[model samples]
Target: MSINHDPKALQNPMHVRVAAAFRIVELSDFEARVLSKGYVSREDYDEAYLLYAEKMTAAGFRVEHLLNSQGYYVPNFSSAARDALVAKGDPAEEVAKFESEQWTTIQNCELGTFRLVNAIFHEQSQPSGQFDS
Candidate 1:
């Protein structure tokens, strides 16, 4: 499938792309699918998610933050449409459903989800003892 690049995808930094898909989906598959639709491969999505922890620090956003927030279902930060569901009453079940569907949708588009994802999770850092520097 030839990926059709969307203008908004440019607004999405490369690192966020990688972070959004990390563990949730294989990065290779994500890249391949997006490219087939004319989307660009953005490594910055990873940097935005992992390297720029400082910018999102004050907001309580971080890679490890959502790992424990029951998978960040409260806000549905994965996509704009999900935010609507997040705002609805009793959206817990809907949020989970959206996540499953997002994994499939994002395979085709670079969503602006990193900022929202980071917003919910607390910033994580290397373990106190793991710093080799």
Candidate 2:
């Protein structure tokens, strides 16, 4: 038996491109400032996470990427993502928890990156780089 792993078997190319574009929206100055702190509590982190996620959703990225709850920050998995994981034989509850945890980790990374970028900027009086428009 052979498994078909063709690229065409995946999502529509246009859909993929649109998704990529939405995810690539540049961080606004305010959002950048909020995440630039060296240390923030989970509560603070969630605030920034939701802010970024809201921007992404408004820009047309899937809403599934955002947290489903204000207090808990649970990740919202799209039906397609959930179905795919189940099809791979993973238990549904476990998969949901895993995905939610993964999103939390991703939020941590986002905050870290903001701090990192600020660190780089602070390392030199004059950081010089050109951003592509």
What TM-score number comes out for model 2?
A: 0.27
TM-score of every prediction relative to native: 0.25, 0.27
Colliding pairs, model 2: none
After superposing candidate 1 on the true structure, give the runs of residues whose Cα lies further than 4 Å from its correct spot.
1-78, 110-133
Any runs in candidate 2 off by more than 4 Å, and if so which? 1-37, 65-133
Weakest lDDT window of 10 consecutive positions for candidate 2: 124-133
lDDT digits (tens) for residues 30-88 of candidate 1: 33343334323234334334433333333332223333334322222234466667777
lDDT of 2: 0.42
Best model number under lDDT? 2
- Model 1 has a clash total of 17
